[model samples]
Target chain A: MSPTPTTATPSDVTPARTGGGRTGGLRLTALHTRAQLLETVRVPIAVIGTVVFPTLTMLFFVVPQPFADDPAQATAATAQISLFAVMSVCLFTYGVGVAEDRALPWDSYLRTLPVGAGPRLAGRLLNGLAFALVSLVPLVVVAWLLTAAALPADRLVLTAGALAVAALPMLGLGLWIGYGMSTKAALAVAQVLLLPLAFGGGLFLPPQMFPGWLDAVSTWLPTRAGRDLVVSATTGADLPGTTWPVLAAWALLTAVLAVRAYRRDEGRRFR
Target chain B: MSAPLVRLAGATRRYGDVTALDGVTLDVPAGQLLGLLGPNGAGKSTLLQLVSGLRRPTSGVVELFGRPPWEPAARAGLGMTPQETGLPPTLRVREVVDVVAGHFPDPVPTAEVLERFGLGDLARRQTGGLSGGQKRRLAVALAFVGRPRLALLDEPTTGLDVDARHDLWDAVRAYHRDGGTVVLTSHYLEEVEALAERVVVVDRGRVLVDGSLEEVRSAVPARRVRVRAAALPDLGADRALVDGDRHELWTSDADALVRRLVGSGAPFADLEVASASLEEAFLAVTAAADDRSGSRSATGVPGTSTPTTSTPEVAR
Candidate 1:
């Protein structure tokens, strides 16, 4: 109250009315990402929970095993756990994150601002992806140090591409859970869903050991499809014709469910 | 002054069968510092939500700045603080302000906003570390960060201590003096008396009174007379409240009530009279409406005849 109006120079802050165009929208999206990521990483426990488990899995389970020196098996094992890292980050980040944000009055206030939901939504997705990428670093470094998880540069790039593309379904599922449930429900759902997708989809164990029936079921799971897609890229194994289409199908279906859940949440909360 | 900044025509909002806002029509001309007065569940917050375009009306028109309230362009000049809000717990106070400011085309520098809200020192602290009063101030401060033409503040000072409340009032006044429009709702009558150029009283999702402060006060002309009395005669007042050694009575004719006390030879002293508190005035009007319609939907959910007793039970 002691301070009166002190209009800083026109250049002092973001110019008003600039949010109408594509550039301004991009800027706002980046701003949202920065703010959300800061809010997230400031809580050290959250970062550790999302980022550490995958690295630890690779360390205790993969690095010290016989597959650690076999180039093909080691590459395949590294690819599988990388998928684990991405899946863990996405599930908790979106599933738990969205539900928690909805309960925040800050979230509602942000919605009331002139910018529509596009920037904030895009920012959250980007923020999650950013963390997923970061979570992969320690695992990759450890795989390089302790395992013969060697791939030609081109194959490594291809494997990265495959993993990135395959992440869509998991991202969609996370969003679906986040928008559809309360925080407590989302946390339970994420936890319950993660292990089955890992073990059944063969992220925890290789599919070579699966009996025919489990293999049949695993092939149809999005996680298994994702695992095959990335593992083949890294190992140069025969690619299945159904891999891309299966991931695409899961992605499309979950995206629709997520959007519907979001609309329903809005109706119940404020409408 | 060119046109009403906001106009609501029979606007209604219903959560399934329970209508939060009834068919209410009102116009807020530019530059009016409006105070919305009501008890719990009176639709004051709902009305602000409609005007701010956070929720759509079920049946009627709600316009802001001559356009649909939901339009982005229409919201450019608007700032709002809902009755309940949350700040991201882990975010530093300045970062939260900056994030909200980023949405506006032109915003006051984050520093200036924090300073004006008396939050300059707390800028680096995470919002989770703030006390209730500090949090409320920051919440209110976000509304003015954009230098909005219209500020809709819902219970901005609800949790503040008197000095903090006064600080917020000063921030609001400075904005209004610069020709900004403000619409705020408060249970504190002194707040309305201090800030509102025009006042609107709402009850049962309907507007009971909409006029200058003077007109609303006159319409419900009950004066509060405070006396220290024991074993008083039956000098009936409109309503009376007792606080141990003090008896506070509301009556339009303070002179007559005092005279009657003397004539009856009731042992009373330390008599004082002022305008009836808005709480007293509001209950009298709502109670009168209750009696006219003979409806139990007045102050207390389960109807009772005692207006003074019923109001305090609901107001807090």
Candidate 2:
């Protein structure tokens, strides 16, 4: 039997058109962020790994040290560990997460949507922020309980803002690796890049104690720039003259690389 | 009249050296249900992707609602489920449906979509824990949540069992009943037969036939003649196959062939003549096109390589 031809009545089936604009884009971003966060939280190990590792490093290494006895050194150590937390969130959330997502068919579906990339990128940024903040809690608790770490209320707020700002470069770097490489390659690259960045940035040692040559190079690294900005904000220490510029340069470079990687992936897969 | 829901004019897509879609033209009017039938590597998926705006044509024009499909606005009324889709493992089925629904300005209720797809019970289950068939169902369900004017489904029921496939077909039928247009590709000819008002048979990146189901079924106008005879008759058949004492001949005019045999005084014990089925017609159409193109390219068709001879399978 032939199918009955039914005319499309506007009231019956016309879809509501949310024109792709700033407001719709923002709404989509919020929805994406909520969904992404729920997915991340369901995997307890992912959150635990990012949160526990940095806190444990501080508890086992920094709290027992004699320098942690001094309020200034303790505050600086806390700031460094917090920076480490932010870095962990950036690398794990965007690097490994994005790479794994790229391997899934859901990623292809999302990429083809009319809402464009704003929602996905913003959602990822929001997720990174959530993980970064969550990772800091344990470190803050450890610092408060076992060490002489102290920060004025206003400085605490400033330190939080500075750490977030500093994380931009790391997030961009993560995106570059995620979009440009396979999941396995991205995972290995993230691990390989993480430790060297942390060590060279003086997250494990004071910049003042670094040899002259190492100190000069460290001043130019984004991680070191981030470390100086956060430590100075919390402990009132002097920052290198190039700290802000170094961070800005790294952020700009990685952002460009990330965008290029995204376009390249899009062209190769969808074109 | 409004513009066609989808229009492709001489659209072609090439991947490296292989052309996935050759110069071809097609138009799907609103509210029409089209089934794209083809063998493996026949470019059905490629054609669907072009309509979905997931890929651009290397040359020629592709439009949705009369606008260039590359524009996001052109794709606003389009929904598609590709050949493969992996749902987020950690998200519950309900959550996945809801999240996808949220993208539309006004979407079908999540519960209603799940219920329609027989996924109500699995709503609370994590997508990763669900069976492959369940995942496939969910993926197809998500495509309808937005109430799109046009839907492109590529092998939507590949992993579904008989019942599941029927249930999915009911959902598609209801959608078409409501005046929704759809273009679906599938390996199951029965699936196409069940849902498609219009059928397009594609092979080797080109369309071999396009018509209504009945038109396509009779497209070849050929019949198969089977008989048991002690001696093989010298009949002019396009093709013939022999199995023991039974002989089968394929010809466009079965009546004439039979009369000729009877006149020739061939002693035939049993004889039967039957019109070609949709399956046979499909094979004949593709095979005839392949033979024509293969011979043409053998002489000289620039950039054309020798066509590989592989028997078409229903499941592929």
Predicted structure with the largest TM-score when compared to the true one: 1
Residue-level lDDT of model 2, residues B1-316, one tens digit each, is 4557789999998876677788879998878899998766777867776876667899999987776765655665777773345778899999988887776666788999899888899999999898889889988988887778888887899988999999899889988887788898877767887999998877777776788987665444358889998777678765565677788776767888889889989888689998764446456544544666331112111112335345232222
Q: Report the error of model 2 at residue B152, Å.
A: 1.6
- Scanning candidate 2 chain A in windows of ten residues, the lowest lDDT window is A1-10
Off by over 4 Å in 1: A1-23, A267-271, B82-85, B221-256, B264-281, B291-316
lDDT of 1 at B233: 64
For residues A1-271, what per-residue lDDT tens digits would candidate 2 score against the true structure? 1221332322233222255443377788898999999999999998899989999989876988999999999999989988988897788789888888877767767655556667788899898888888888889999988999998997978888899888889989999988888888889999999998998998877787899999988988999999999999998888879999999999999999999998767532432
Which residue pairs show collisions in model 2?
none
DockQ of each: 0.34, 0.33
Q: Interface Cα RMSD for candidate 1? A: 6.3
On a 0 to 1 TM-score scale, where does candidate 1 land against the true structure? Answer: 0.86
CAPRI quality band, candidate 1: acceptable
